[model samples]
Target: MATSAPLLGKAAHSKASIFYGADEYLEELKKRYAHDHEIAALKNALPGEGDPNAAGVAQSNDKMLSVQKNNENRSLKTNRLFPTPNKPDPMPQNLAFLFTKITPEQMIYMWNVLTAIFCSQVLMVIGYCAALATFPDYWWTCTLCFGVPFSYIAIQNIYIDHDVMHGATFPVYEWQRFLTHPFADFFSLPWEEFVLEHNRHHASTVDLLIQGEFGWDPEEFHYALQQWAGPWSSNWYKYLLTVPFIPVIHFFGLNDTGSLFALEWWMHFPDEGAGGKCNKEFWSKWIPRRIKHNAFVLSLWACIWLLGTYPLGRPLSEGWRFMFTVSFFARIGYSAAWMFITNFTHSF
Candidate 1:
């Protein structure tokens, strides 16, 4: 039920560290922690802010009730913003004052999260193996119960890759891609391609809001699923395509437009010939990158299968099922969820 604008910079930090052991996270302790009592008390016995909640002036339940209703009551929901814009500042604040703050706990968090991500990857394979070996004919029950949620690691990787791409994770931005790649490449697009694609989306922010005079968007695909638009395929045909490998389709370059395939060959490669012709030289430069990415993705799948078979002591087939769960099944679930959200949103 958060309502106020997020606190930025050091205003967001908790000055206190863990009192006993190392703090597991950031955030100031709450003041009047969990005071609601009536099936709940009719009155507050809890202290106000800046004190231990032993005893304080008791008030009616109005404050708690009002606060929990904050979003519904706020005037910010109107068609016109209720509050006027801020007056221009004669003395502009220093940008450094709002630069993100980091603490010792926050510094080690990347290693902690990366460990969790990779370790969970191993656990995911183990879970699949356990399901296959233990239950035999009923193995799919375990995958349905556990593998579905676990496969969301693909989504998690994209989120981490997003932060890394934005250079917000660490000051060593160039090296951050090392954390993103091959891992985030699970989605099949190289980190560079994702960066370029996402940057263009951001660059098109105004265009997304304002359409051309013709009443259509300037660009057909604002939300990255451009392939689904228009007379591309029948609905059931798209589902059939999705069933085998569409989740990882971007990896195979089937998701790429002809123009996208002919785009720049990245920074270090030889330039495409003048006017962006799709001649042999251009294809030669782009094909190498395509090969590298395809290898990475295939190798990742093989590692999962091998690890599942040898170490986890399950049939090698279980690894393949795990891949399908995370890719095809996971993609379907997420796409369905995302469709519900964007279907009603102008922000898309």
Candidate 2:
């Protein structure tokens, strides 16, 4: 459906006047002659309704007519004009107020800050893992179980995933975006796809007919479940506490299909071509693209796992393991924080 444009200030004024019978009406005629020069002054003040001050003049005249008496007739005219203030047009919604307008230099500064944090996470993991390796016999029990995976989870999952998604974690070169954007398939959903879907969500927001399809509305899901499950259904607390489960649900490809509409677009990037190839190419292209991403992700993970398991000269297997584990956890933490921030602001 097409969106209705907002009304302008002049259009609103003219529309209001027509509804209240302000122009060329019986009451207006009496007001015209009630004080002979009154209408002339109004016409001078308001050249046409298109004039900027026309609404103001019309509104002020409406107010004055109420008190100015004409004793020759009834206490007031049969129809009375309702006065309203002249309000300006509303401004458009701003999606990128916080960061988009920032200078490229400032953006570069943010990029550097993010890079430092990412590098620091890697360093910390290596340091921790090396210390564990040195005391392997003594701390083997404690380090083997917890230390390794935690570090991997933090670095890969939190910092690296965040940087790529925001386009901040890597160098600004084309090769960097090309390399990192693919990583989305592994740790999180596809960033390019997510951004495209996000744009539509912003465009449509509370449009109830279209808003909830892409897992945007948990309330809708709970409501549906409650209807089927009946009064014995769990309360919202029991229902909503499962929010953190959404990402995992998405990861397992449960909500993987998301909105069919967005997927339709994905299959048809730029979405333009000849008829047969256009339709056939969507799935033909989509499957391989997904597979390629999966292959890349699996290969990357395999390398990480291999490095973690085998001794690489002086660097012990445990050290690599810790680095991988911290990276993963850090990503999860960052994803949770980012999601909460988005939902809190936009859901308002």
Candidate 3:
């Protein structure tokens, strides 16, 4: 009986320990549940209606939510801040694609050709000036000497400008940007306008009737003919006279003058109302800049002519005459050649 009493006492102690541990665990779980309940109540409370302690808890939770939202927003902003780099366009497989292939040998050949052409122009100009200076009486010979070479150079540059427009050159040679682009602009169509017009032509493969330099639209042509040949003139005579002059007019930049009026109309009368007139601000700013650019280019040429002639005892009047006469004849030659080649069998 004594031994049995000791065993029972030990079992009782073990059972009490187990019960104590279970009570501790239950107390911990109850605390956790109470904490969660308080949080829920705080969230559910109306603004300014909860207990002071509950309000404080709600405010803290509100701040936490706000911070979390801001973190998410910041994450979103960071993701969008910098864009991925774009891949370059792939080369097209077409006739125009041939221009894209530029081997080192080809580049060297082009460089050599450009150098020879530029040198020839310089030599021709020098010879022309020398002839004018030495034999002022033989003006016709001087004219031919200057006009032929100058025209050749002009037309060659025009072709180069065309290539540049088509991205066949210049764009490949980053180092030649200044010479091929801005400097060239002074002698040909403005680079910006040229690219715009050329791109329009390329994009109009199916829609060829769109108005442009080479397009078949006759609105501007008819207007020009009426102004030049008189409104009542025979259509056949007008066509004969005006058709030949189209290329010359284009080369001389006269074709663009009509756009000034159109621009003025568009700026002020965009909505098509009769009360709208030309915008003074446009005239004051845009027109003057264009005029200045053209005048500056012309003045540079005039200076060259004057300086070249002055050295040879040629009068300024004779120099001016020489300059204009050569320019006129060269333009005529260019126009005739271009028209003959491009419109040989085509009706338009």
Q: Pick the candidate with the highest lDDT.
A: 3
Model 1: lDDT to the true structure: 0.38
Model 1 per-residue lDDT tens digits across residues 1-348: 111213111222333632211132211111112321110111122111212221243432332111111233322222222122243455356644443343424333443454456566656666666666677687668767665665466456555545443432221222233334343324344444444333333222223332211111212232334334234445546534433333343332222211122132233223234466443443644465456655765676677657546454557676665455544544443333323322223233
Expressed as tens digits, the lDDT of each residue in 106-180 for candidate 2 is 333443444445445445445545555566665555444444554344334444434433332223332222243
Where does model 1 exceed 4 Å of error? 1-115, 169-187, 211-219, 222-291, 307-319, 332-348
RMSD of 3: 31.6
- Candidate 1 or 3, higher lDDT? 3
Supply every candidate's count of residue pairs whose N, Cα or C atoms clash at under 3 angstroms. Answer: 3, 27, 0
Q: Tens digits of per-residue lDDT for model 3 on 126-201?
A: 6777787788899787877678767767556545544443322222222222232221222433333333333322
Worst 10-residue lDDT window, candidate 2: 1-10
Deviation (Å) of 323 in candidate 3: 1.9
Which of the two, 1 or 2, has more lDDT? 1
Q: What TM-score does model 3 achieve against the real structure?
A: 0.46
The per-residue C-alpha lDDT of model 1 at residue 61 equals: 32
